[model samples]
Target: MMGFGLSIEPQLWALLFAMVRIGAAFVAAPVFSAVSVPLPVRIALSGAIGVLVVNTAHIVAPPEIFSINTFLAVAAEALIGLALGFVLQIAFSAPMIASEVIGMGMGLGFANAVDPNSGHATPALGQFLSLLLTLLFLAVDGHLVLVDLVVRSYEVMPPGAWIAPQRLLNIAMFGGYAFLAGLLLALPVGFLLLCLNVVVGMLSRAAPALNLFAIGIPASLAMGIVAILLALPAMGDYMLVIIREALAAAPALVLG
Candidate 1:
């Protein structure tokens, strides 16, 4: 403390405590949480944001770092951070759900690929749609919006204060939105594919000798491609809406 013009202990402690929230948020966040994102990068980014938080917000670290109160405070910070990120994660899953419905409708459900972002096997169409959503999310500055929500959340929950149990219940309740949004997103293509399937069924019954297996797959595949292309604009627009709604919902978790 003597060597430096100003004391660093208090400020440094606050910065470290602030980083805990930012890091937890990033760990659960989408783009930032990708398997490809390195650990050092996450730490660096969280640390950078934490500094901004310390400068602007009054984040006082616990006086006794080893006390039970400090432990509770850290847990609270992590809980708030997780809630903020998990809300967006739920929204992002809609694209995967929509892809699943449309893929099955188009007979592409068997085609699977590893999603580079999540490193999990998903239907090929799901992978494509998820990537599109990710790009659109970045194009619309969603990551920055999410970050802003995280920063402003301090005004709502602050550090060391436990989040209300009802808010956690609400976050859990948001799980249903994904299915509803996904079905809506898949409706257009799915409806058209349904018509095609019905027509194929009629054809199969009319010509008993005609191998339905050979004809059905090709017909469904070709029509599915066409249906997807036709529905592209609406899907893109819906994705933007999803992004907006997801961002809008995030504030509700922390703010009144």
Candidate 2:
């Protein structure tokens, strides 16, 4: 007669640590971290991917888990995961920022709705642009690319790898690009609205008793919508580039 029992191995510990990183990443990532997605589903996905990573990659387990060094290693892993996800978050936010600018310029700032992702009241234009970006993100399989980057990170950076301060600074600098991209996206519509405002001001000065508010508001709104529609194709193109750059940068940040 023989009895069999299960024992936890070093590889199992490595898998668990890997799952911690993956789960942290999903928690900070855009689509996967959406409020609509159940927490359990996110955990399952992290665990599944962690299993795949452990099976495919040669992950080195820390000699001890209940020690100061292991704690620091775990912290490092979580930071790497969070950095990877945060880069994508910054890229995704560019559309929302552009929408906000355009919405304000169009005199539609008052038309606010609850944002599905943030659960906060945002201008309707911002919501619309965010939705478009989200759809485009899916269409291009950006999520798959993100997952691939995270998976590849293990091989490139490995567990317990220390990220340098210069790399962190670079990540912060990368976020600045989002603001520039957003400004560029809104520039066409914003410029048109500015021109409309100037023209409206001139007309109001020429006719002292005329109601310019009624005319200016509608004109700006109409022109803004048209500008956005016309610029959409270009916006898509720019967003695709941003997404690609963000994905490409993840490995560098992690490996650093």
Top candidate by lDDT: 1
Candidate 1 lDDT: 0.89
Look at candidate 2 and tell me the lDDT of residue 60. Answer: 80
Tens digits of per-residue lDDT, candidate 2, 1-256, equal 1222224566678789888778888888889988888999998899899999999988887888799988998999898888889888888888878988888888887899998887898888888877887887898898998888889888878887877899889888888878888998888778888898999999999997888887988898899889888888987788778777777777766565
Question: Candidate 2: misplaced stretches above 4 Å?
Answer: 1-9
Error of 1 at 165 (Å): 1.3
True-structure lDDT of candidate 2: 0.84
Worst 10 residues of 2 by lDDT: 1-10
Deviation in Å, model 1, residue 16 alpha carbon: 1.1
lDDT, candidate 1, 1-256, per-residue tens: 5856347777887888998889998988789999999999999999999999999888889988899999999988988888788889999999899999999988888999888889999999988888899999999999999888889888777887877888888888999999999999999999999998899889988998999889998888898999989999999999999999999987786454
Q: Could you give me the TM-score of model 2 versus the true structure?
A: 0.92
Runs of candidate 1 with Cα error greater than 4 angstroms are 1-6
